[model samples]
Target chain A: MSETLQYIGLGIMSVLNGPELFSIFGIGVPVAIVMLMGGLLTGIAVGATPGLAGPMAMAISLPLLISAFGFTPDALLPVFAFLIGIMKGATLGGAVPAILFNLPGTPDAMMTTLDGHPMAQNGQPKRALRIAQLSSVSGDTFSDIVLFVCAPFLAVIVERYLDLPEKTALLILSISFIAAVMGASVGKGLLSVSLGLIAAFIASGSDLSPRLTMGIPALREGFSLTAAVLGVLIVGEILSTLEELWRNKHALKVKDVENRGAIDGLQRGDIRRIVPYIGRGAVVGTMIGALPGVGSTLAATLSYTLARRRHRAITASEDPQFGTGVPEGIAATEAANSAVSGANLIPVLSLGIPGNAAAVFLILAADSIGGFNPGPAVFTFTENEINPQLVTAFGIFTLMALGNLLNWTVGGSFMRAMGVLAKIPAHYLLPVVLLVAMTAIYFQETSMFAIWTTLGFGVFGFFMRKMQVPVLPFVIAYILAGPIERSAREAFSASGADPWFLFKSPISVAFLVLSLAAPVFLSRGGKKPS
Target chain B: MRRINQNMALGAVIVALALFALFAWVPNDTVSGFVESKRGRLSIGDAMAPGIAFGLMALSGLILLLEARKGDMPGALEQRTFAFLLVALTACAVSFGVMIWAGPLAVAVFGGEGDTYRNLRDTAPWKHIGFVLGGTGLVTTLIALVEKRVTSNAVMIGLAAALALVGVFDLAFDNLLLPPNGDQ
Candidate 1:
């Protein structure tokens, strides 16, 4: 249609208007492009390492970016561009370690090791790496396009139809789904959510009444979201690492993995063989990503499992199996995991609820840099004024595409450079990271008490991880609690004091039912051992 | 089994939270026995946190109790893992131990105008944040090195790294506030 063409032309123009859109050091530099490249490079390095993942990188980088950019609308695009770059780059970078060293840098890469490592052992490391790159880039591109199409539609529908009570129910449903799928058990997940809600409750500001801060002056100001997240996710992780180091103090053997094996480009036939599996992975990954919290590991596992089953059904059972370095195995995993990078934003942009830890960090970064509020109103169209938020979202999509393009070109070298990245000893890294996290918090809050809060939360987060309670649900709950509270209050008031008002609407009723049932059924069906 | 201990720990935690919701904390600081949120007048939103917290805590506690009846809730978290966690925690705690006394002592000795918290601020005259941070780094490194029974060289490096961290934060980010002299 002409409308589609017109939109495409506009998109092209905006992308080309990069120099005008972005500036750094008062120079007309393409800031989004630079952020995308820098974030991608950082992501690739972090992901290729055995211990670090994309979210960890993003969490550490967030405070630095905030300090640099300050709290401004212009900061959002560059920050997100870098983050999206990391999300995309990490997916591909994870495959490097899994294939070359048989060490999965992240959980999703666990599956990649099955086919990829075997391929490395069988002297097809380059071929396997190439397949992973192509499949990953393909899957990410496919999912980004889906996100570009679907997030707006989903948000528009919610804006048009959903009211306050329905919105509350929808958030409940999201919480239920996230809690159901995240931790070891639904009970544990719910407990984490409750704790998060409690934290939010403690922090909630009141008009006439005193908040539930329990009388301490520091408590009155409440907990900072950045400090909490940095403490819990980044600093807690550092403590955990330190614990590991102390326990393994005598076991400091530097793993000297020979960075041999020249990576060869994928042939047309290799690409042809992988195309179908990549397509399947994209579809599987997209479905999982759009949901609240079943993350990329599940997507990769399911996609690879299905591909294996389908391949077995089609071909002779004895002929080249998935475990035997088949291209399809790599394709399925890489593509599926990669698809999650973009599609994970769906629930985030549409509902303003972060489904997973990575999404939580993204939302935290967005909160730090204001002017873009995620929710149904974000998708609202007005005839008079331009929807800058929606425009920013579109701009983010363009950056993600550029990230994929970067991965395609520089990703091979990234795999080779993994040795240097992974070699940075944890003892050195942890100390510096701890300092940085504390400093960022101190600068932002201008109070050393905030730093203490960060440390306390870090300890608490470590315990939460150790206890097997999922941290993601807790954080998401904490983040969404204020908004949900407002919605619930508004909905209650609007219902003329009807106690059972949430169940009055069919949509609300359906969502409420789904929220209740999801935990029971989904938790029962969970793969984690009891 | 260790998972059994974890279950009990979780149960204990839930019980503690539930009690807090029901009795200890509420929206209002004003009322007696059964009051929820305290208000100057009457407000509808006062009961939201307390009421929600109570209900949700009860439900979660009940569910956790039910799970405790069944056997192993896996994914590590045992007394053995708790030992290592304690070690890391102690190191971190030792590092921050100075922070607790630094502000109060600084005020006592140097005589700051504001409260204890203010004396600890980046701008506080009495506070020497750099030395405090360096001291923390020293304690952390000392703890780790003594535990490992490493040579003096390792101790020196740890001390160097601690001071380096203080220096790096100072130079790289000028406006960044540390314990006191920590920024310098």
Candidate 2:
């Protein structure tokens, strides 16, 4: 306990003494504020628009930030903050179109339109928007707090027992966790995971001719993480979205609304009604976040499902009011998604394995700029090399907390202001996003290859989405495969070809046992296989 | 589809086995031998023959079986997209062949123009062409720039550029007619 405290103290002191910490706090905090405001405005615009989404916004912003700022840590801070802020705002922003226009800005926000648009037709647009915005802020703030508190505690424990064999076991455990947590069938998930592992293996380097390449000189150095991620997430998603556009060209278009208005203030009754559901959703979201690749969308869907089930069980006497764009639905969805943002960072920070595409990009950015290879060693290495700078972690949490708090305090009114701003045409938005993405990819390595890869991946991502194959496994596997392979090799070297040596260590034995048991436990209470 | 899955699984197992064999039987001393050979002190043929020979044999056995099975698979050419993919694959191979004499940039420009820009317009043809041209030019320029600025050996940058381009293309063409590029 004392040692743990000492480490925490050291972490704090490291932050306090470091010049970079001061610079980060000084520059990052204010820039974060500006970006948050800008993102909030962008989110409202995108959310109010017919076809745009939070992820699209993120993809567009990612490249622009990378191009404008390069891979510097200081540069990443505000961008990440903006991303988080926009995601929060967009959740509510999406409800605008869902209500007034009978269109959802994003797929996950479709549920809101069920009752929201009906309420708008009934002349309760203000009430519906109020409920949605308030519930969203409540959930988002709650989840942010959960992430801020939980991640470091998990990190501390992870740091204590992290070693080569253990790290390898942890990686295997992450793969298993992802497969278990995925909404897809186990067979499909396993296939995707296997493919991801194979992809990573192909991209990995060897002393004599890089692995798996058929004498292609360009492949000798292996694949770049930034390129791979951009390809899989942003590019893939764009392609998929485009395909949807092609297929659904004649789909019913929502009539555009004339006068968009702001959400009214939430009543005490509304707050009281949603408190329990919000708490449950936040907890569920945070837990899902901790698990690799089980991101916010899944978290929100699961939480809503669970909330609905619980509501059904408890309110048997009354007609179950779930999925009615009620406070509970908004609370559950918002909390779950917000919590995931923070929870997704746990594996990335603790194990150096990114849990999602966004986290993977952050890891790559960190690698390129900070020269800090994330893993078990990051804490130890940073403690010794740049201990004074470690305060940035603490500051990040604080800033995240502050950002969420600020968003909550003024978020509803801001949303009200945003309804007016959502009138921007898609033509203007799409080209800007494209330009930003292109520029960011160009800056990543200053190579055209990265840009092409991003575009290509956008298409692939699109297909994968259409095919119902989860992309998270691929991203997670790619990020973790290197460390897992390296750790396994080291463990083998240390144990001198003894297979049982892995089991001989108590730490490794315990981790392996837990890893083996996770699938059974997760599968047991899992929702009836979709 | 089931047969393809089965074959893929079998190929994976064979590759795993081959890797295991290399890890077990191949001597660690070959790393030094390769380094020495590269520095012109000794020929890799003499110094690392055992490792290289064993590795080649194992790799060939795995590849041949996989390829034969892949070739025999039904509906291999049924998809026009798959046919286009094959053409792209052949173009890449030809470009690599050309690279031996023409160097990376010439082959890259030719490959880019032939494979990417020759297709029909789905969205904006000029936009797509611009994307391809800019992408190819960026790769070539980066290799040249990096060679001058960092390493004099443009091979490393060229290789990096090629992998990026191929990765993007592979993602764009989701069909599995062409094997994934070995290096990512």
Candidate 3:
């Protein structure tokens, strides 16, 4: 515990004494803090705009950040700080569009539009925004606190208990669970996972000769990770959105509302009324977020349902109900979704499994930046020497805390002013986004091959989405393939090439059994996690 | 009915691909077998992971096929999808062609007798030419295709975006180079 505290202190000091951005009165401001601020503002802008989200911004920024700060240990803190700030800021900013224009900027904000739009209609737009900001910050802070306490302990426990075979089994179980829970059916999900594994294995990283390059010279080098991922996630989304827009010729226009005796601020009574909803939202959001592949859309939905039930029971017949411009509805949804941003990191930090797209980007950033990697080893403490990864982990936690602090102080007003961003048509933005994404990929890989690969993957992704196949399982499987193979090989060698290595140990057997059973037990049809 | 047919077709395609991969592709493409013994130490080989993956795909494909017969419908692609893809890909190809060949063509036409695009690729005017032209064309073409009209506003926006990207990526960062230029 003392060692942990010492490491935390060291982590805080590292950020404090990080590469100076500027000096203020004989004191230096670290680049990490400034980047955090910049990322938060950008995240707000992106999230406020309909059809733009945190992951897309992070995807576009990752390569740029890498270019600015090379693959060095010193770059990790600032880059991570920026990404985390974006995650937190976007969580708050997603509520803006929902409240002002009745459009959910991000899918999780769908619940927000239920009450937020009505509140805007009732001339309590400012009140709704205030409620959203307060509850979001409160829930976000609660989840961060839980993460601060939980992630390190969980990592330590996982490190102590899991071995090579068990770890390999665990990765399989994670993939299976994700496949089962995501997409239309267990079969389709598994197919997506298989395709991802094939993509990852096409050019073998470990072997002297490439495995499945299929006689293509470029395949020997394998596809670039950033290109493939962004191709599917961002470029694919762009293509799909553009197709819809073109087919329907529908351009969305936001209608302005006249302020009718607008009440802006929340009272003491209002605060007291919403606190319970916020607490419930925080707890529910955290629990769901800790489970890989379950996202904040479910969290907000569940929390809003719970809040509605309780509110219905207590309120008089004449009182404003949950969805009829009530502050409580906004509070419940905003809190739950925002809480998810912090708690999503729990799985990533503890077990090296990403729970959502935002978490995936964070993991990608860590992987690209090269010095730090997330997993149980990240929390490992030694008696003799300092663990740099542990310090980086603490630095990430510090950034989260600072982000929550900024959200509490200024995020509300910034969000309220972002109503105009929601007015920008999505159709106009997507093509530009595609061009930028291609440019970003090209600049990083410095090859036209990467651009072509990205375009090819983009078309594939579009088809997959249209066919109702989930893309998340495939992406997660691709990321985990290398680690899974490494663990399997090590376990096989360690156990003298025992064919049934995964089933030999009780824990490994249990995990393998669970992997098989996951599809049967956990399959949820065709629901996209936001 | 259309959705069900789509699912069935998809399932069949998946099964065929998986079978080909397992039987023909894996064997032909991979130099190593599923397992190899090197110097009396047995180890898993390159084909093991892909073999298992393809096997999984096969199982999934069979399941999907059966499920489709049982009246499960996921979704179907519309004819508009192919049309959209055709147009989009055509635009991308033409724009990229201009991007790749524009600089060299310009150099051949207008440069000093012995000067080549390679020599001038990093220099001003030459470096910015391909990116600005290709990027603007791409963006403008996409917007025009979607909005169903070619507007000057779309062209200006695309041009501005291309120029701004150049300013930020090329001028601001000394290490970073724009596309095709980077390839050059």
Candidate 4:
């Protein structure tokens, strides 16, 4: 307890003592803080815009920051602070469009649109925004706190107990769980996952003589992660949206409302009522977030579904259904999604694996920058010693706290403003988004190859969406497949006369069985969510 | 005109792809200049792509075929839009192909620095970006205009977008190492 308190005190001291205030727009702020604010500002802007996403912003910023900072120890904190800020800011910012315009800015924000748009149409935009803001910040703080307290301990436990077979089985468990979580039919979900595994396999051979390059020079280089992701998620979204507009000729824009509240932020009574919902969402989100590969969409969807169920139970014949712009609906979705921003980093920091796409940028950046590979080794300590990486992790937690504070203060009004702005026509907005996507791709990879890759994936994504195959399963599977394969191979090599090496460990056996059964269970798990 | 059934069309494509992946890919690679030794005994790693692709194709094919087998009326609205999307996709791919592959050829025929191919490859974001933006924008605008889905000012909008994108990319990301357009 004393050691924990001492570390917290030292973490605060480290942040306070280092770095003088630097000029951002000529206003003096600490370099670290400014980067945080700058990234947060950029993320909110990107997240508010329907066609753009936070991952795109992170991908675009990473190379620029790497070049500017020039691979120094001092540079790491500022760059990471900026990234952490963006990750947090984007989650909350998605709610802006989801609420006012009924357009989900990101996939996870799909739940937000249910109640948020209705609330806006009903002239309670302010109330909805306030509920969203409160829930988001609270959930983020809760998850960050959990991450700060838990990651080191979790890393130690895993480092001690988990063998290669266990790790492989765990990954399989994650894949199965994620496949189950995705709403697509079992076959489609499995197909998406299998395709991702195929993509990973294509580029990941030790011999590296272009295994499945199909004789294309570029294919031999394999797909750039950023390009593939942005292409499928953002560029594909752009193409899809454009197709929608093409169908309509002029897709009607949601008319702008006041986008502010008559009453101030949440009332005391309202806060009291919402506290339990926020708590539930935060708990669910943190648990999911700490897991290796499952992501924010499930958290948000599950929480929203649970909230609706709870509401249905409370008022058996209630006039207001859950989707009728209820504050609880906004609270549940925002809290759950926001909580994911912090908790997703737990596995990334503790183990080497990034849990989701947002965290992938951090791994990508860290790998390129060199000198720091974030895994269990980063958490090791001896007698009378402190782990430097642990200290940095604590510092990161402090940075996130500041981000949360910024979100509460300036983020609320900024979100309100975007609520009004999000109603702008897609035709005007999407062209610029496409341009930005291209520029980001080019600047990062410095190759037209990356741009073409993105465009290709965008078309592929369009088809995948049309076919009703869930994209998240594909993404999650892609990220984990290499690790799973590597671990399984290691286990195979390590086997001491055991042909069924994976089935040797009871934990592995149980998890593998679960891996096979989870999808079947999910398929049978009643269609009515919750 | 009888509307082509999208499900049936999709199912046929998937089945064809699955068959190609399962049967033809490995044999074709072996026939080509690839190592006959490696091709003769394919590893699990090597087979993963074809195996998975074929499986995915089969699953998608089955789903789409099932949908088609169950007699259903086509949503008149969706068929034309879906067809239009395919057209748009074709336009995009064609423009992209030209932008990347045909830039040097265009330079060779028209005008540019010496070693047109090398220059096109080296000055990727700056020189080649011009081809990409210009070609993609032109094709996209022309299609949109022809479909009457977009206004005639699409050309102007495309031009403005090109200027803005190139300018911002050049100015802000100096560290991006993009070669300056048109000879150094």
**Residue B32 accuracy (lDDT) in model 4:** 26
lDDT of 2 by residue, A1-530 (tens): 54435555654443333233124545532555566667766766666665577666765566555545556666645665566556666666776776666776665566566556665654556776777776666666665666656565666677776666776677777776775566333433444555556556552534564445445676656666766776676656543443333334323256644433534445558778778987888788788777776666677789888888887777755563775546677667766666676677777765677776556656765665564455545444342344422344544454456556666667666666655444543322332344345545554455545555665565555444544446777677666666666676567556655556567678788877876676556645523222
For residues A210-322, what per-residue lDDT tens digits would candidate 3 score against the true structure?
Answer: 88887889888887888878888888888888888888755445667668887666766989999999999999998888888877998999999999999999999899898
Q: Which candidate leads the pack in TM-score?
A: 3
- Number of the top-ranking candidate, with DockQ as the measure: 3
- Tell me the lDDT of model 2 at A189: 47
Candidate 4: residue pairs that collide: none
Per-residue CA lDDT of model 4 for A370-478, tens digit only, reads 6566766666643377655656666777888889999989988887777555665666666556655665666557676677788888877776676566676676677
The lDDT leader among the candidates is 3
Model 3's TM-score against the true structure: 0.98
The CAPRI-style docking tier of model 2 reads: incorrect
Error of 2 at B155 (Å): 39
Off by over 4 Å in 3: A524-530
Candidate 2 accuracy as lDDT: 0.55
After superposition on all CA atoms, what RMSD does each candidate show versus the true structure?
4.6, 12.0, 1.5, 5.6
Quote the TM-score that chain A achieves in each candidate.
Answer: 0.92, 0.82, 0.97, 0.85
Clashing pairs in 1: B28-B38, B128-B181, B129-B179, B129-B180, B129-B181, B129-B182, B130-B181, B130-B182
| Model 1 Cα lDDT, one tens digit per residue, A1-530 | 44434444444444446545456687776777788888898888878876577888888777767766678887887788788778777888888878877777777888998898777776677788888888888998898889888887899899888998999999888888887888877888888888888777774645444467567777766788888877777777767666666667433223443435645456558877888999999999988888878889989999999999988888896788999878899999999998987888888888897876778877887788988887767766555566666666666667777787888898767765674555555555555557556656766766666777888888888877777777787788889888887887778767865678798999999999999998889867644521
Q: Which candidate would rank higher by lDDT, 1 or 3?
A: 3
Candidate 3 clash pair list: none
Interface RMSD for candidates 1 onward, in order: 4.1, 15.9, 1.4, 5.7
Chain B TM-score of predicted candidate 2 relative to the true chain B: 0.23
Candidates, DockQ? 0.31, 0.04, 0.78, 0.21
